[model samples]
Target: MTSPGVHAFLIIVRVDRFTPEEKNTVDFIKKIFGDGAAKYCIVVFTREDQLEEGQTIDDFINSSDQLKELVQCCGNHKFAINNKLNGQPLKIKIDQLLRMIDQMVQSNRGKYYTNDMYQKIERQRKREQARQEEEDRKKKKAYEESLISTGREIGRQEAEERERERQKEQKSREKEPQKTEKPEKEQYSTREKICGCSCHKYPGVIHVVPCCSGTKFPFSLLGP
Candidate 1:
């Protein structure tokens, strides 16, 4: 009988004597459950006195492939119950199995099943960061280029201004007049002068006066 509240627990009880119907039931269980039934424990109940002198339960089921498959399907998890003894060991084993299941569930509690989703998110974040960095680099390069062009323009302007100032100075220098020094005046003394005239004081302005005979002054009498 299946309990509605105990969906995680699957109990399969075998009859005291094995029959075709019982074997068919076990087969049906295996077919229906498969690996899905690995969550449950396999409880094998047996009467201890029914066993042969040298035979063990492990030896008995070793030849049954179906039984082996059933145990393997449950991840080889099995607990034996001897009906002739107290059920303390079975209870303890069931408790331990439940604790293991609890631990498994706890360990996987925070685990995300979809690694692809996380990877996609991480990739997108990196791409966006790279794009932003590229944009920033372009903007910085453009700003530096602008500053270089401005500097060149300023240098050209200063050169033109200096050239204009030099031209203006050169033209002013050329337009100014150049001064010339006057020559010294010649000296004369009366005693050294010819015709005994005070040439220095009188500085005679000679007139060619005609005598009574109308004779002209000789050219040789004038100073050479």
Candidate 2:
């Protein structure tokens, strides 16, 4: 349907015998092509040999309500041809069709057929595509932002956990009991001052000795 796009659409029909389905095609064409469609459409009738003597295309139109209505819808553009006939008759029909085409072209100032509805549809399609692309871009940006936000949240939580651990350790150290030891008092004993044979009782003659030093009296000190 999209091939080469349509410059003009030919609607062929058997003038003498029209089926219900065929008659409906006219309305369908108009619907698809829109208002400008009629200008480029031509009603072509086949089976022209079926016409009785002196019967013409006008006579056929006058005879059939469906045909007349279809022609009117196409702006009264109609032509007839008989492929079954040969020589002069076929030539005449072909010539008549060409003349009608010429007249239509001239009336339209040599403009080719165009479908306003098709163009409108194409424009709408472009607009829709652009809108979809914009939506996709917004979604992508939102996804990236979400990832960034998640990362920041995770980093903050980790930092807070570390801070909590540090505070817990500080509080533990503060709560621990401190140990203190008092200085011990030295014990002194009054001993008879005897050094050799000149020892005399005197407070200055003796010095303070540590009890854990394994010391003995003066007589033991003189032994070795």
TM-score for each prediction?
Answer: 0.33, 0.47
Across 1-224, the per-residue lDDT of candidate 1 in tens digits comes to: 23221223333534246555544544454344432334443435356446667877676556567666555654555444456554787577567656655543344452222334334545766787899999999999999999999999999999999999999999999999978888675343322332312233443533233322344444322331
Question: For model 1, which pairs clash?
Answer: none
Cα misplacement distance, residue 65 of candidate 1 (Å): 68
Error of 2 at 118 (Å): 3.2
Q: Could you give candidate 2's per-residue lDDT for residues 1-224 as a string of tens digits?
A: 44334545677888667888777776776555556657767888898878888899789888978878888877788878876978997788788787787787667667655455577756766787899999999999999999999999999999999999999999999999987887675345435222222233442343334222344445322211
Q: Considering summed lDDT, which 10 consecutive residues are worst modelled in model 1?
A: 1-10
Q: What is the C-alpha lDDT of each candidate?
A: 0.53, 0.71
- RMSD (CA, angstroms), candidate 2: 11.9
Against the true structure, whose TM-score is highest?
2
lDDT of 2 at 146: 100
